[model samples]
Each structure stands twice: as structure tokens, then as C-alpha cells.
Target: MSANPQWDISKALMVARFFHLLCGARDACVTPFLTLYLRQMGLIAPWVGILMGTKHLIATTWAPICSFLAKNYQKRQLLLIGSLLGSAAAGLLLTLISPLDKALVYRFCNGSSSLMLPINTTLEKELAPNHSAGIKNFTIRTKRSQVNSRVMMGKGNPQRSMFETTDSSLPLLHVGSELKTPGTLVNLSLAERTRAQDRSLALSLGEHWLFLLSMMAVMFWELLSAPLGPAAADSLYEYLDFVDATDCYRRLWVWKLLGMSIGVCSVPVLVVQLDCFLAEDTPRAAVHFYGYTAFSILALPVCFAIPIPNFKRREPGHKAIKALSLIGNDCLLFLLAVTVFLTGATVANIENFLFWQMQDQGSSELSMGLSVTLSLVGEILLHPFKAKILKNLSSLGTLGLGLGCLSGQLLYYSLLWNWWAIFPAQIFGAISNGALWWAVDALVEDLVIPGTERSLSVMLRGLFYGNGASLGSFIGGFVVLHYSLAVLYKTHCVVLSLWLVLFIAIQSKLPQHRKINYSKLLAVDTADASDSEEGAERDWLIKAMRDEHLTGRAKNKY
Candidate 1:
């Protein structure tokens, strides 16, 4: 291939969009479902948590090392493509592992969800869009919007929504729109309880061995996938600069949100269509893993096509050292790290296990899909206003706002009764997930010791998203095991509340010299900048990444 080869901006954007879309879809297919998928394998809550926590732990630790090695060699083409293919192969291998496809304890658990059927199903004429079941599925609502749960919680049948579709005059109910009572193992017969205990005992015999084995498998999977995030970010900036699209770079990431919704929504469709063609006992959830593989493989080809300009760069070790040096000098640095860590812990809770909780509430796959779509929509709608938000909330306050939103979302989730109500609550994600990321990214950009901009970003993200998420998932999993999902989410709200107070206290006490220049980075996310403001911010961004001789010291404060 020729060096400095040109790609048309339209062509580059199309390729870039496709790349992100497919990757987002690939990740979405498995992410919201993975913990529940593990649960379907007869492992309880803590084991699932351990596996996920370890996965994040490995991914985070390995990521900075991957970046360090890449900078040393300065060749990402081979590594990026290899990671994608390897991650895809790992997912495929996961699907290939048997008995996990079916929720086999003693017999196949058929389904593991407990979504409530709409209250007026008999009076209704059509099922909600989320429900695709046509195969004579019978659910009797005890109250309007309450699901007639035949199976216990966490035993929702995937096939009911996938294979049982009909045009009959049966009123379509939104399953788990309301719960008649808080769900538990209370309603089972003595004999049924005995059988459940027997199954539990049997599962316990092999639980430890299996947990270790699954943990290893997932750690291996994440090892291949973790570095891709930073690599993708790097490639994104490079591609944008090549196409002269840096001015609109932040908004361009909206494609990722769009793609994630598509991927999540696609799962129910795939499960339904595949069930029509597959066998009686085929594992329906396998569609998630296999579908993810397909998208990842599709994205592999697009990786080669992205016009990320290849260029020589220096080793990032000294830069990393400079970034780390700030920890000692900056008093408020601890507070920032704490906030990011807590944020990561809470976010990992929501993304990793929220659907699993909803499933326990008798939620359907279709409803979960809608939940994800709405959450992403909220993020897309709310993220662009970051500049305005910063202008009003100021640095500390914006960070607090993000944490507040996360806490509120967790609070809402803990009290979740009507599954339909969960849709509106996801608006909290706009601030918690999207605006929070923007605020942190911008703060890192502003607060770093000048030339160590990129290094500091990677370092802090590794701390929070890697270690913080891992720690939170580990603890949160046990919480779900001992208490309930509701209790765990409520606990998250409490933890966030305390963290927020601690954060504000520390930030308020910080001297002016220790604060970061948040105003300078306000334009970090604004694509709608006027002509005068746009030129300065764009140049600063471009030069920040490229300039080796950056002309600033510990001048910027947060």
C-alpha cells in the first residue's frame, strides 16, 4: 500500500461509521445479556460477579501495557485487527461451550426472565412491540399490567417471546409492567422447594470449580478485547484529522450510540427468526454470542479500510511518568480519581447487571431492548449540551451532577416495579454515562501536566474503568447474592451519595492553585462552536496530541 494515500471524506466517514456501528452492535449483543447468560448456566449471582469483575480487571491492567508496547513499536495495524478477530473468536468459543446455551440445572430452565404482562391484556388487541411471541403463550395478569408468572423469577422463557407469535385477538400485555408482590421463592410447594434445594446442592458441588474455570475463560476473552478502546480512540482522532473533521469529532461518536441500539434491538429479532428455523431444544440465547461474532468479523474488514494515517511517534513512558508525577503535587487529584473510580463502579453496575435485574422482575428481551434504545437515545440527546452545562455547573458541580444522575438512576432501578416505567428512568443515563464521560475526558485534557495529555487520560481511565469497575462488580455481585438486586442498586445510590458529599467537601477546600482550568476545555465537546471559537479549540486539540514541545506546566487546575 502506498504511503500518504488519500481517502475521500465521504468514503472515510462511511467506513468509520460502519466500523463503529458494527463494533457497537457486536459489543451490545453480548454485554447486557452476559451476566444473565452466566446465571442461566446454574451459577448464582456472586460467581457471575467474580467472572465479570476479573474480566474487567484483566482488561484494564492489560490496556496500558498494550498502549505502552504499541508506542514503543509504533505499529497498531496488526495489533488492532488481531484483537478484533481474537475477541470474536473468543465469543464464538463461548457459544460453542455446551449446556450453557440451555439453562440446564436438572432440566432446561427454558427461560430466565420474569417480565410483567400488561394489565388490560384481555381488553387489548395487540401485543407490545417488544413482545414477538406468537406461539400460544399464555400469561394471566393478576392485576392490570401485572405479568402472570407461571415460572419463578429468573426462569423467563426465551422461546415464548421468540417462537410464539400469533395474529390472534388476544390482548397484548406488556409483561412485568407491574408486579403484584415483591418476587421471591415464596410461592413454591414443599416438594418444589425440596427439589430446588436438591438442585442447589448439586450445583454447589461443582460451583467453585466452574467459577474458576469460567473466570479464566472470560479473563482470556477480555485480554483480547481491552486494548481496542484506546486504540479505537487513537484511530478516531487520526482519521478525523486526515479527513479534516476534527471540528465535529465529539458528535461523530453518536454513531456508536446508534449502533448499540441497533445491536440490542437486533437480538430479539434474531432469536425469533432463528427459533423458526432451529430445533426444539436449541439454545436460543446462542444468537447473542454468534450474532456478536458476525458483527465483529464484519468490522474486521472495515478496520483495514479506515484511513487512520500511519505516522511515527515517540515512546510514551516519560510522558506517563510526568502524568503520574502530578499525584504528589496536586492535592485535589485524589478527589478526581475517587470520583472517576466511583463513577466507573456505578456504571459497571448498571451496564453489567441492570438487565439481569429486570429479567428477575419478569422483564422480556424486547423490553430490555427498548430500555437500552431509550438509554442511548437519552445519552445522544443530552451529551451535546456539555459546554452549556459546564458553563453553569462549573467543574466540581458538573462532576457532581454526573454522580447525582448516576445515583438517581440507581435509586430508580432499585424501586423498579413497572417495567414500562423503567423506560423513562433511563434518561438519567444521559448525564451518568454520556455527560460524565465528556466531563471526565475534558477534565483530564485540562488537568494533565501539559504534554502528558493522552497518557493521563489512559492512566485515569485504567484506574476507574479497570480497577474501579472490577472492584464494584465484585462487591455488587455479592450484594445481589445476599440481598436482592433491588437492595444492591439502592446500596449503590447510598454509596454514590456519600462519595458525592466527600467529593464536594474536598473540592470546596482546594486552593485556587490546585484547581484545573476547566473553562479552557469547555469546547472539548462542542461541535456547534461559532467560527471564532471553533478555530482556536480545533487547533488546540490537534496540537495537543501532536506537539512534543507543549508549552505549559502545572498551570491548569481542575
Candidate 2:
């Protein structure tokens, strides 16, 4: 096969963008609304937590298996199978199951269906053409689709109440003209070049596995919610199969956010409409299930129709190494994980607790929905400014700002008894959560070694996020049960404040460093080390050695 393969830009973008729309719609119908639906069914806080936790536990367990399949199989086929199975499971819950059976089927279906996320992202990256102009054109068309979806969905309040947190990691958009190419070096035999490529592939696969294992270990506490968005995004970039990474990511985000908005906004409308037609509560859920089923059915044909280009998979010749061997030595990654874990905890706490609090204060469904919509609108409006903010403040600095805002929002909620107080609080929450997520995304990309699996970093982040959220939800159920709402908010504030302090302390000690070029490592060049002594490769090696020594010292001091 030639080094550079040709792709149909128009077809690829259309498929990926449309697929995102479907997935978004599916998520809107289910994930965010599940909690509200359960609450409506008269389940208390603890039962809600337990059900959500069960789903997370099952999803986390299935992740490694899904990752393995993704690495080895035809991703498009896996996505199709997952979508069909998930839809069927949802159908069973909708049409056939009693209340007792609902939770089990929901958990199973949610986990099984989620497997499609990473596969879809990987396909999008693989199929997108590598030209700036093509990507720009694709983004323009995708935005129009998003606008149309939102308009058709209807807009009284911003559809924010049913905010389902999807994975935020997608392809990194590279806008620069000077794309990096392989380093110029002496010519090698055809056999040597093939071996080099094979070795590179094996090393990457091993790194990804190692990261996966680490995430699973660290995220064992995660028992609610799965973070699949970033993982999919990371996979898209990792394979190095797609062109114009940045443009691809932009299109993915636009379509995804749009779809989610539509899904979330539709729920209140569905509930109100269903209440009139069907006396039993089951009918509302059935409608949701049928909606997902219809979307899943439509998705399969679209998946098959997408003209995805085929790439040959290479078999690795070496055994995979331990996860720790590749990343255990990196101190920055550890800190990043801790931060991600805390962020997840705080976000989950806010998400789970706030809704219940609103209901307790006698807020109507429309009012609560409007609050959520406004919050989401705040988040969306703030997103475009993220790049500018990050440019001015370091990732850590931005994180601190987010944490501070979150702390203030919690404090406000704790003090105020009025329902309308949540409006300004939503604005604060948006800036806080949005900024924190954006910083974490950029930090993960920056900290990862260029040649290794970027998806692993994302997965690891997801693990932390999931772990924190699960623990938070479990503990939150008890906290809200045992204590006042004021106490819950105060507790969150204290925890975040502590994390902020630790973060600042850690940031103060970290070194200001140059970018490490891992092109040699990525190339897997078989040539002797001496041949590559004249350029950035030599400098990179020296910096890596120095960093390793410093890391050893830091470990001893701790």
C-alpha cells in the first residue's frame, strides 16, 4: 500500500457528522433523562445512585474488552453490532419488562451500546481527508445540520436540564501550515523500512494496553457514568490515518453538541405529551425506548452506506509490556489524573444533587429545564473563548479559575433558598465546568508522549472521571439522605478548595520545559543511534534522560 491513501472527503464527513447526530439523539433520550425518569417513578436518592452505579460498574468492566475489539476488528462492523444490540436491549426494557427488571436491562443495554462511541470516533478520523480546505468546508456544512436539528427540536428554553456528559476528546484541530513530516535520514533497505513500521505499530499498541490497565486499576472506584468521548477522539488522532485533525474534531463537536441539545430538550416535551395520552408511567419510558430503537435501526443502514476506506492491519511481533513501565515514571501524568478525578467528582456532585434540590424547592419541570438550558447555553457561548483563555493562562491556572468559580457557585446554592438563585449560579457553573474540562483536555494532549497512544491518556482521564463520579454519587446518596442540602454543597466546596491548594503547590514545583520530540521513537528507526546525532533527536534524548533522573529524585523525596 502507498504511504498516502486517497479518501472521499465529502462522503466521509457526511457519514461521520450524521452518525454523531444519531448518537447524540440516542444519548439525549436516555442518559440524562434516566435519573429524572427514575425519580419520577418514586425511587429515592439511594436507589438512583445504586442503579447508576451498577451501570457504571458494568460499563467499566466492558471497556477493556471493547478496546481490544476496536484494536483488532473492523470498527464499522463493531459499531453496527453494538448499535443493534443496544437498541434491542432498550426495546426489551420498554415493551416487555416490569419495574424490577428495568434496571438490569437498562444497565446491560447502556454498557453494550456505548461500545459504539470509540469505534465511531476512530472511523471518523480514519476516513476524513487531510486537507485544510476540505475540512473547513466540512465544518461549514456540519454546522448547518446542527442548526437545522436545533430548530426542528423547538426552542422555548435552552435544552440544558438533561445534560448528558459525553466524552470531550475528539481530534485535535491543527491550523498551522507547517505540518511535521518524518525526519530526513539515510536511506534504508525496503525490508528495514517495513520492520521499522511494524515495530512502531507494536510499541503503540503496547502503550495503549498499558494505559488501559492503569486506568482500570486507578478507576476501580468508578461505578457511575462512562467517559467515551475523549477516548474516541484520542483514537482518531492516534491511528494517524486521518487528515486535518483539527477540522475533523470541530465537525465532530458541533454535530455532537447539537444532537445532545436536541435529545435533552425533547424529553420534557415527551413527558408532557405522554402524560396526556397514557395514564401509566410505563408509556413514557416505552416511547423513549421506541425512539432509541428507531434511531438504532436507522443508524445501521447509515453506517453501512458510509464509504469508509479500508486499511491493512499489521500484526505485532513482540509481547506487550506492563502499563507502569511506560508511564509510571511520569509525575505530571499522575497529578493530571488526580485533578481529573476531582473534577469528575465535583461535576457529578453538582449534576446529581442540583436536580433534587430544585425539585425540593418546588421548581416546576419547565423552570428546571430552562435553568439547565441556560447553563448549557452559557457553556456553549464560553467554548469558543477557551482557546483565548488558555493562551493567557496556563492549563493549571485555568483549572484553578474553574475550581474557584465552582466553589463560589456551591456557596451561593448553600446560602440561597430561592429558586431563581440558580440562574446566576448556572452561569457560574458553566464557566467553571467548561473551563476545567477544556484545560484538562489540552493538558492530556500536551503531557502525552507524541508517539504513544493518545487514546490511553484520554481513557485514563475517563477512568478518573468515572471513579470520582461513582464515588461521589454513592456517597452523595447517603449525604443527601443523612444531611441537609446546605451540607452537601459545603462539603463539595471544601473538597474542591483542598484540591486547588494541592494543585497550586504541585504547579509551583514543576519545571518549565521545552517540547519533547519523540519522532525517533515514533519512527522506530532501526539505524544505529550515531546516525541521528545531528538534530532535534539528540536534544530530545538528552532532555528525556535528564527528566528521568529528576523524576527519580522527586520520587525519593516524596
Candidate 3:
């Protein structure tokens, strides 16, 4: 790596943190407020729910659109444009009318912001340290996770089965398909396979000018982010999966996603309850509560940083680094999945509730601000745990526990109409989010995607999550618009039940193994007897074991 004093390690870390914060604040400011704004315009709860869900629906629609651009245009430039579009959406919200106008603007913003996924993931990879990308993934994911939870409100749910928060659409990106040589096939034919391809495009004068304008817009927003907010976590899952022959990155993602997705669906019911409770009283109290929670979550990244493994230099032959990076990458995927769902839900829930409340009472702007602040605080509580809890539990076990808590939280909150009841449910924010941060990053590292492909894998993993969130949000809105609160709650519970089943199924397949040889220091410390004496031998043995566990090697190589 080349040394540039202007771009030191600390600076890079700071930039990554800043980027995460920007996304968080923008998400937080919009979701809750968008809902509130709609209600003020005379839309009913059903309409508000539908409108809010549109955010995710639009995001899903745009994932492929943004992915196409990402492959064809300068990713950074596309992201800048996305940011501007998001700002335009916010600006448009100030002038509201029929639900249709609101929906159109919301969808546009959702799709535009969807472009951020690939660019954001790419930037995180760029800022990461070469050998200790695990730490980098952990740190970036944690920071972003917390921001997402705090601002977005916490994960949402369609059946209203988890902790309630605001919701937003998760962005998606497509990276052609799995890497492959020209013509190899086992189960599927070439026509059946989806190839992950990259195509380069020429930059024209018009494109360059548009890029410049977008950059300026992003800078404007970055300056205004302070005094505002939005964010989760899971990271060690990859290590456990690697050891467990049946647990691959894809399967673990399915389970973690199930838990997180259920949470995403729950936000609106909680919002309605909160809105009704505050209808007869002061709504500002709720906002203050949200604010307090958001500020609290900002402390989490520092907390997790204390326990993460660090590598000061590259590993010899990059073997240890490769393994660690793979684990971290897979874990990152899991964490991103959880956080994205939480954020999307939180943003959606807050918006739905705020719209219902504000429309009903003609509440002051201050009260609305306070409500958003309270949601942000809830997310803050969630940020720290992304990496901390994984120190003990397997990815599935941790997620299972989190989902169980979420189910209980939803049912408990649904029974009580009091505002106080909302607080107890919000507690799930920390546990579910923490697991996301710790478990997913570990998965990424354990997967050990090569540097050349790291950016694509991370983006695609993000797409899976973003796409799921979009669908979940849309369905949640559909349920809200068509069903009673009871129906909504019951539906949420059912979805969560299904999510639990999927999680269990995936968990059942997880492979178990002993810990990796962490006896080495500085990537692959030669001073350590383990690294020098047995590193290669152990590496071969581990590979042989995994190969046998996977498909049973037909022939063995020395």
C-alpha cells in the first residue's frame, strides 16, 4: 500500500464513519417525518401505511436499475446522484397533497437512494485495512448498523411481531453472478446459470458535468448532518459456519434474514399504538424518548472496537488474512442483512406512526422532531451489541434468541396501549442489532472473498438484504391498508413464526469446528510456534477436512 499523509489510517476510518453517519441521518430524518407529513395532509392510517410501504417497493424496483448503472457508470457518481434525489424527495415532502403525489416522490427517493448500496459497500472495502479487513468490516458495519437502527427506528415487522421503529427501503445491487470459467457445469446448464459480469463505460462531458453537480449536492448534505440522525449488528457467524460443514454463507444469510425480516414487518403496529396513546396527551414526550435513544447508540462502535481482532501487517502468503477476511465478509453479510432490515423497518414504522399521530392532532413541529429523536435513541441502544454478543453464541443461536425476544416484545406491546409499553419492546433493538453486527462481519471474513471480488460480493449480499426489505416493507403496508390492528398483529406473528422455522432449518445445517489458529500475531506471526511449526500442515489438514465434509474428495492431493 502506498503511504499518503493526507490519507492516513485514522483519516480513512473517520471517512468511513462519516459516510455511515450520513446515510443514517438521512434515513432517520425521512422515514418518521414522511409518515407524519402524510397524515397531516388527511390520509388515513391505511393510506399512510401503503404510502410508507411504497418506499421499500420502490427500492426493490430500483435495485436492478441502480445495479445496472453501477455496472455501467461510475459508482461514486451514481451514488452522488442518489443522494441528491433523496434530498429532492425530502424537499418535495415539504409541499404535500394527495397520497399519490406523496407516493410518487417517496418511490423516486427510495429508488434514487437505492443507488447508495454498491457505492457505500465499495467505499467501506476501500477504506478497510488490507490484512485486517475483518476489523474494517466489523468497524464499518457496526458504525453503519448503529446509525441505521437509531435513525431508522429499529427493525420493523409486517405482523407487528418485533420491536417497533421506523422503516425505509434497503438499496440493492446486482453483481452479474457467481464467478466461473468458460464452460463448467454440474447441476445447472450454462443457460440456467447467472453470470456476474462487469462492463466498463466511457465518461462523456455531459456525464462528467452531472457527476460534478451531484458531488456538490452530497457535500451540502454532509455539512448539514450534525444535530441530526439514524442504524445494527451481527459479526462471528462465519467461523462457526466454516467449522459446521453444512453451514455456508448463503444458508446462514437465510436464517439471519428470517429473524431480521420479521422484525422489519412489525414497525407500523407499534407506531399506531404509540400514536393513539399520545393522541390524548403530549406527543413531544415520545419524540424526546426517541432522541435520547439515538444518541445512546453512537457509543457502540467504540465498545465493539475493544474486542475485535487486529492485524497490523499482511499475513505471509496472505493465508491467514484470506481466512479471516472470508469469515469477516460472511459475517458482514449477516450484519448488513440484519441492520438493513431493522433500518428499513424502523424508518417505515416511525413514518406510519408519526403520520397517524400528526394528522390526528395537528401536532407542532417540535413534537414531531422529538418523536424522531426518541426513535433515534432506540437505534443507539442497538448499535453496540453487533459485535459484543458474538463472543459467546453461534450465529443461529444468537439470531434465534433475538427473534424470540422480538416475538415476545411485539405481543407484549400489542396488549398495552400505554406509551410506556413501547419502551419495553424497544429493548430488543440492542440484542437483535448486536447480533447482526458481530455475526455478519464474521461471515464475510470466514467466506474469504478475494480482494478483486470483495466489492462485488459485499454489494450483492447487500442487494439480497435490500431486496428482502423492500418486499417486507411493501407487504407490511399492504397488510396495514387492508386489515385491522388485530389482523396486523396476528399476521406479523405468523410471518415471524415462518421466519423462525426458516432460521431453524438453516441453523440445523450449520457446520461446527474447532477455533482457527489465532496463536499467531501480526497476520501470520513467525515468532509463534503454531504459525512457524504447523501453519502449513494445519492449513492443509483443515482444507482436507472441509473438502471431505463438503462433497467427499474423489482424489486427494499432497
Candidate 4:
């Protein structure tokens, strides 16, 4: 894709909005429904679990690699566009994977027992001419069983005793005495049964193979596009610099929420309708696939129109070392890490258990999904005010408020008596998840070592959303198994309350400082950077080491 020649902020922002929305819609088209699609395709629970986990693992593994590539290269837009198109192409290939219909096209394709009904078999000499009709009925039953094999859940009858009639009631001459005389008729039927079973087994294996290959290819393409959200943030920052506009990086992500809300909220209803009309019991995943393909293709053009202004990038290793030093030196990083970890854990529990709790309170999945719309709207509402919040409370202060609000929400959940009660509680998402997100991003932006923007962004994204969520989910699974939602939520509320107090106590004890000059971190030369960011970092490092030494940890390392 070619970059647009006209690239004003107003024009670029519109393009950026469309790109983000399309990205969100594309994601909604496939990801959330993929497990259900697999189930409908006759995959069992264990296989579904493995496939979904594999997709997550791929995202976790490739995210950092993609970030590195984005950081090291120019023409990031080109990489972005390629990934978009590649994923679309991969999705389009799914149209070729519709369920296989016939099995016996092996003995004449070489061929069910009778339906095991009470119908009596007769000797060839005594049988009526209409015996062929009975055989035809058996063939119909066998084909119906084949249909069930592709049906959702796809459960089949358990094996029956040999006395049961097989559905392969064809070639009527030796129907009854064939067992006694094993002639050409019996051999043909037996061979047909064998071939049919083999064909069914082969088809099953092929579908599984196709699923594995399709998932891998799609995930591989997505790996290249993983840096998009972070890159968008970096681009926004650069644009702010270019236009001499005030930086409000925290608010920018509201667009993401808006787009995602539109996608996640609306698509499921359409998908339900599609599933109902397209196949009686089977889901129509082809729509999801082709829909994803279309959205990605649509976004490809938007990428060209969106401007991603580049700075004179710093040395890669130099930026990396800068990040390392910041981590080692800044106490704020520790606080940020622990907070985001807990935030991720809290989010995980909510995602995994909130709906379960709601269902127990008589909520439908429909209500559960619609409730998310309210939560997202709250988050978006809060995002724009982050600048004011940060101004009033500072990063740690804003974070403290977030923790307090989160605990409050948990308390409300503990007391929830009805499904509808969650609506009010979830509206507090603005203060809890949204505020915490903004606070964390604000601090990260403030602490960012200039040219390390994309690198740092991607790294922390993986930390909070990936590592923290993984650990949270692992722990939450056990917690939920033993405890009721009320008990679990109340316990979490207590824990968060303690955490908030500890956070405040530490914030008071730690050496606090004013915000660093943003421009200094962006310096192209080391000497220019050394004057401000380096000096501040040195002072902060000394304070941290002294503090750690007093605590008898890392005493000799410095």
C-alpha cells in the first residue's frame, strides 16, 4: 500500500479511527466465536482447549518479536498492511473446509446394518420383491447417521450387540442365509462396510488436520500485526509532537474501546441469526471467516491514509539499555508492575467468573454480553478525563484511586442478589479498569526512554495482558472451584483493600519526584539526553540503591 500524500491530523485521525474500528470488527468476527465453531465442527472439548491455548501462546511468543521488528525497521505501515492481507487470505481459505458429505463412494464406493428394528430377515427364495424397499430405508438411516456425525455435539449411539441389524440392508438376495453361506453378496456388503468406516475415519482426521493448519496460518499472520495497537500509540505521540498539540496519550485508547464495543456487541446477534438460517444445527463459521477477511482488506487502505511520523531513531541496544536501567533504577516501575499484575488478575477473574456468577443469578448469555457494552462505555467516558485526573492526583495517586474503586466494585459484586444488579456495578468500570489503565499508561509514557516507545509499549502490554492474565486465570480457576461467587468476590474485596493501604503506605515512604521533561527523552544525541533524563535517572538510581541497601537487599550489587 502507498502512503497518502496529504496527511493532515484531521484526515489522518479519521483514517486511524476507521483502521482501529476495522481491526476491532475483524477480531470480533473470528476470535470469540472460534471455539464454538470448532465444537460445531465436531471437535471435542480437549481439542478445543488445546487449539485456543495454542493461539494464545502464539500471540504471547510473537508479540515481542514483532515489536522488535517494528522498532528496527522503517515502513512499518508496509509490514502492517502485509499482515492484514495475509490474515484475510488465510481466513478466505476456510470456505474450502465445509463438511464432507459422503463416505461409501469406496466398494461401489464400497458401503449400514438394518436400524436394528424388529423387522425379520428372510431367506432369498421366500423374500417378497419389495424387500429392496427395506434395504433402501436402511441406506437412508445410514446417511442420516452420517448427517449426525457433522451435527453439533455429534454424539453417536454406543456400540450395539452383533444381533442388532446393520444399516447396510442392500443387495437383498442373500439377506438371511448370507451368514450361513458367506458368498459374493456377503463379501461385497462386508467390504463396503469396511471401506465406509475407513472413509469416515479418514474424513475425521482430515478435518482435524485442516483445523490445526488453519489456526496456525492465521495466528502466524496475526503475529506480524501484533504491534499495531502499540504502534498506533507511538504514532499518536509523534503526531502530538509534530503538531505541537498537548499530549493526551491516555485518552487515545478510548477509540479502541469504542470500536471494540461496536464490534463485540453487534456481531454476536448477527452471528446467531446466521447460524439459525444457514444450517439447522451446525454453526456458519464461513461467514465469520469471510467477514474477518473483508474487514482486514478494508483496513488495508486505511493504513495508507494514516500517517505514522518517524523520529530519528536511537540505537536499538542503547534504547534497550535505557529501558533496563529505568527498570532497575525506578521504584515506580515495581509499583506499576505489581498494580498491573493485580489489575490483570482482577480482569481475568471477572472475564472467567463474572458471567458464571450472573448466570447463577438467572442471567442469560445475552444479558452477560450486553452488560459488557455498559462497562466499555464507562471506560471510554473515563478515558478523556485522565489528564485532569493525573493533574489532580498524579500517577500513583490516580492508581491509588483506581485500586480503591476496584475494591469497591468487588464489594458490590459480593452483595449482588440479582443479575440486573451487575449493570450498576459494572458501570464503575470507568473508575476501576479505565482509570487504572490510564494511570499505568501515563506513568509508562512519563518513564519511557524516548526511542524505546514501541519496545516498552509491547513489553508492558505482554506483561499485564499476557503474563498477568495467564497467572490470574490459573489461580482463579482453583479459587472459583471451591468458593461461591459471593465469598470469592468478598474475599477479593478484602485483599484489594489491604493492597490499596499497602500501596498508599509505600507511596508515602518512597522518594517522590516531579515529572521528567518529555522532550529530553526524545533527544537524538546522548549528550542532549544526558543533560536532563540521564541526570534525573542517576539521582533516582542513587535513591533507589540507598533505599534497597537499607532494606538489606541488592546491598553489594550496585
- The candidate that wins on lDDT is 1
lDDT of 4 at 457: 52
- Candidate 1 lDDT by residue in tens digits, 1-558: 135466666777787777787888888898888875666554566677778888888877787678557646756777788888888888765554443213232122223222333332111122111122222122221232122223432355544432233212223333443332334113546574454445434434555555666776787788888887667767666667656676555556788888899999898666644332243433567678888888888898888886656655443357556666775566666577777788778888777778765654556677888888988888888866878988887666787788898889889988877667788788887767776777776676656644465567666778655788898889877776555677778888998899889777777676544224445756576575446755766665555543422332323432
lDDT, candidate 2, 304-385, per-residue tens: 5544333576444121132233345556667766777776766776776575566444444446666776776678888889
Residue range 427-532, candidate 3, lDDT tens digits: 5644544454445445444443233233334443344444555455555544544443334445555556566776566545544332333323236534533555
Positional deviation of 35 in candidate 3, in angstroms? 1.7
Worst 10 residues of 3 by lDDT: 194-203
- State every prediction's TM-score relative to the real structure: 0.74, 0.65, 0.47, 0.62
Best by TM-score: 1
> Which ranges in model 1 have alpha carbons more than 4 Å from their true place?
7-13, 100-201, 238-246, 272-282, 514-558
After superposition on all CA atoms, how large is the RMSD of candidate 1?
11.0
RMSD of each: 11.0, 24.0, 22.0, 13.8
Q: Please estimate how well model 2 matches the true structure, expressed as its whole-model Cα lDDT.
A: 0.54
Model 2, C-alpha of 160: deviation from truth (Å): 34
lDDT values for all models: 0.64, 0.54, 0.37, 0.56
Candidate 1 to truth, TM: 0.74
The sequence of per-residue lDDT tens digits that candidate 4 reaches over residues 270-360 is 5544422254322344566766777777777787666766557544445545654666677767667677667766765565456545533
